[model samples]
Target: MSLNSLRERLIERLTPAGAWTPDGLPDRSDYDLNPDAPRSPRTLRPAAVLVPVIARPEGASVLLTRRSDTLASHTGQIAFPGGRLDPGETAVQAALREAREEVALDPASVEVLGVGDGYETVTGFLVTPVIGWLAEPPVVSPSPDEVAEVFEAPWDFLMDPANHRRDFLEPESGPRRWFWAMPWRERYIWGATASILRALHARLYGDEARPGAAVGEDAA
Candidate 1:
């Protein structure tokens, strides 16, 4: 799709009043919460992230972060700019706050389109992914205490199916485990974050376009 068309579609998809469930997306049961078993009584704190997309002169790219190792959970994983929700804050407010804190991104420059479905993490946090369009590029500096690095990935590459790989690992006694992998340069994007991206791709594009296919190509 042309950039203009893509922007229009994204705006329509992000309408505030529209449905935000990942119903027609890939079945995340293989990766998301367990339904039959009772989960431990953990606090369902609302968390949010800014899935910021920059429409660069060359092409569109999505902002991402490499977390600092000091973090107790998901310490060094590749992720979006986000964190726990604070008291009296809405999901969008939390997302903007986190982005500003982690990456020095200006909240005023982001046009929040809509939010994706909430994904419950095994660690007990319910994360809401907020999709936003960056109106203008802003200077970004990573917070040494919370962010290891901040970078951008070509949206076309991420949206393509060819670059996504399904990998498995064998636990101590259980069968092999499965998860999504979308690698770029030295960074490996996987686990809950990858699952969220997969769902987003399915929603924006179609399911037939698996992950990994558009890695090296220009946007169609």
Candidate 2:
């Protein structure tokens, strides 16, 4: 598809911005691959992330960040720019605010298209992936404290099902845990980050392609 067509199709497929509802769609979770894992009913904190798809002449790319090693948790992990909501901020508001705080991405530069599926994390937070569009390559300055590095992954690579792998790890104290992992070059994209991308892939192209269908120039 041409760049314009790709952008339009994304907006058409995504849940409209500001129209998010927890009950509106099914939620993906860390336990998706672990069917035997016991799940308890509990309150989940609200969170949001900015899934920025940058428009480049060559192709689309997604904006991501590597969390700073100095952080208390999830150190050196790749993630979207976002965090828990503050006060009465909406998901879209928090997403934009967090992006600015984490990577110096100007909210004005982003044209939010819509949100993807809601994801419940093992850490007890319900995260909404807010999709944003950047018409040009963004100039980002990663925060030294919250973010270690900022990078972009090709949208085609991320949306390809062949790259999505179901991997598992055995812990000393629990049942074997399984999660989605998409390894790209030197970066190991997994956990909640990978899961969110996997969900987005399904949302955009789940019905359009047959199982094992190859990702091509137009399919991307």
Highest-TM-score candidate: 2
lDDT of 2 by residue, 98-192 (tens): 99999999999999999988998888899999999999898899989999999999887888888999998889998999999989988888999
Question: Tens-digit lDDT track for model 1 on 80-197?
Answer: 9988878777778888999999999999989888876577775667787889888566689999999999999888767766777888667797556677889988899887777777
Give TM-scores for every candidate, taking all chains together and pairing residue i with residue i: 0.82, 0.93
| C-alpha-based local distance difference test score of model 1 | 0.73
Best by lDDT: 2
lDDT of 2 at 174: 88
Clashing pairs in 2: 1-218
